[model samples]
Target: MARYVKISSLGPAPCVIEAGGSAEEAVERMIAHWKRMLGFVLPDKPDLIVMPEACDRPSKAHYPKEERLEYYRVRGNRIRDYFASVAAEHGCYIVYPTHMQAEDGSWRNTAQFIDRQGKLMGAYHKNHLVPAEYDANGILYGKDAPIFECDFGRVAAAICFDLNFDELRLQYVRAKPDLIVFPSMYHGALMQNYWAYSCRSHFVGAVAGLPSSVLNPLGETVAQSTNYYPYITATVNMDCAVLHIDENGRQFAAIKRKYGPKVKIHDPGLLGSVLISSEADDLSVRDIIAEYGLEPLDDYFNRSLAHRCAPGHMEP
Candidate 1:
């Protein structure tokens, strides 16, 4: 059984994540919560660590995108070092996912996951960024989903915004990872529905996206909390779920085939690979990337806000 823990917690300090606050203090708070929530720290310190978005206070936007990106990169490294030191102290591998950061000055948003040895393991750049933010332009928006390797098993990540797109999840699924973690900022009743639907619909065994609660590989609600700030954990056994396949080496599913004659649902899950062919002309490569861009990442960021504002585009 694979153990996946999801926690709904608060930031360490008021201004650390925002700017002009102590990042060390924020990390300390996060560590304390981890120890208290998980009962005991990892023996090998687990291969991957998953964390919610924006846990740290962000820096003010006076600096240009390049400078801002550098600032976050440096700060992210510091924060990871802090977490890694703790993971090493306790003995476990960690894949910490924080708010997206852009390095190389190319305007790409990324999720950095480090291992127990305090080495940068792998990163998942936001192929799908939120549109409103200025950083959504150029190299940041058009990209593919990449999964990282870990000691326990292959792992992939879904940012808070990535979770809403079945396409992103389908892309991660193609990686055939043993686990997929989503670190999000959403809560309340709506999250309640997503929590349940994500398990039953998306991940067959591994947790869908992390939030206040966690679901098991079997899509079962293993644990939850009544408090406003909550954390939950469950063990995942990768060998459990079967990856459906046909004789032609194609995974089989008909959900999209069942759509209306003019509309087709592309089940990226049934087919391996983030880029898949579909009969649906409406769904294009650009559309997929636009929906999942990283820098401006948000749950509903990709939806057509423009069309909604202009009623003329609405069909009768």
Candidate 2:
């Protein structure tokens, strides 16, 4: 069956905080900014909404160590509560990214996932962090990669710096989550598209001061936020599979001939692969692949690897 999900990725520039403002006042101002940002997309009724990393961080403000700690102390959980309320009221899942202090006094750059009912489903503490995050900011590196289960599909998260590391990306490739949500301050360039194609999952990136985008499994940008609009809402089908064109070309034609408009064979050109998505309620991508005996891209690669290592195989 078609597992369609509407997603909204917001990329508004970081909220500005007055250098001399009180922490309470700063929190209120940040909340108001986010409320206005969310207002622009809420009417689309997105199943999931993603915000940029450190969504509540102040822009163009320099705070001393003592002042930063005091600000975090005063801002504790207020922004989180407001996000939960919005998720509850809107009945949609939200990815809220921020810096959170642990019980032991250390902090983690985290992305918390809120369920449709406004409950805390799970949080992905950033596994990779820049040197400044630990040396100057006193933030600790996370060790685990957890996949959150939502009504729509399996979801995973990667913070800004996390996009550059293959260690984390390899784990996600093994887990094979349907979607990878990236909340970042950095744009990550081609790494974003690489991760989507390598993991064979749809990728949504919400970057502060950059274009937020939704990419298909083939690493093709399906939708993106433009200069005029800081947020973009797009609907994508999660019921899809990536297959190599090597042995699947005939099968692709056969499936398309049979299903016609009920399936989509998207060729991103020069990739030697296609993304097949089911658009019919009675069929799924898996079913179509089974019916057509199509080989998945990874499986095809694995098979080739085994053949290359065989005893009689020719040397490269």
Candidate 3:
């Protein structure tokens, strides 16, 4: 079986890059900790990897078009160059997203999946951009959710807020991905609740990647070491359990019936808002316990499902 690694990481901003430590430092930290902590118990080296968004610190010098493309071109190239170098050194695959401008002025947060040989295997551009990212009118929003294929399994990306949309996730799920990755930069007072909700609800037996940090009003904890700031990288095995199919063919009717009233559900809009909505897949929680034993899967599910999401529209 091809082994895969899901990376949940906090992004390194342009400021971090200027202070003697570039975004490469954050990548190194994630790689080092991933190997040191998770790799210690793994049977073999991971064959594929996934990372959160904003891997490249986008700046005018590096991200502008025409006169600016040159700057962004060089910086963008660094992201790939570094991954290739590290993949060669570690003998592992690395997947990440870069800021790419489409024909128009808008940006496409394109996810690039690379093999251990440093070859570019697949790419997917983000389709959902938040309204807060827009100007006064709230007209601009991202518009695509593409899934890609890899040697190990099918790979797909849902940048941060994208996971909040059930319709989008379901569209990806219907395709039956072996692994789905979500990289988010969600930071707010209630993020603790939101992050927990997203990981537990949408991701089952499938890894949900995150790299988050809390910025204090005061600069008190800003300079703390790795101990003060940490990230979560969880590995979920998709092949271990099966979805429950009732005699009448109701897969997950119990949970659906329970939460249907409270949670507004809808289809991903083809011509409406970018926020997608739908029900989570019909995964068998009991069967997961039976196969993997109740300890791990139970603990994971019991974590909670209260991640904060924006208001979703009802199905038309």
lDDT of 2 by residue, 1-25 (tens): 8999999999988876767768788
How many clashes (backbone N, Cα, C below 3 Å) per candidate? 35, 0, 14
- The candidate 1 region of ten consecutive residues with least summed lDDT is 200-209
How high is the lDDT of residue 177 in model 2? 97
Over all chains combined, what TM-score does candidate 3 have? 0.50
Error of 1 at 12 (Å): 8.1
The TM-scores of all predictions, comma-separated, are 0.53, 0.97, 0.50
The 0-to-1 C-alpha lDDT of every candidate, in the order given, reads 0.44, 0.92, 0.43
Winner of 1 and 3 under lDDT:
1
lDDT of 3 by residue, 192-217 (tens): 33332232222311112223432111
Instruction: Candidate 3: list runs displaced more than 4 Å.
Output: 1-15, 18-44, 58-73, 102-106, 132-144, 187-236, 245-316
Better of 2 and 3 by TM-score: 2
Worst 10 residues of 2 by lDDT: 60-69
RMSD of each: 14.1, 1.3, 13.4
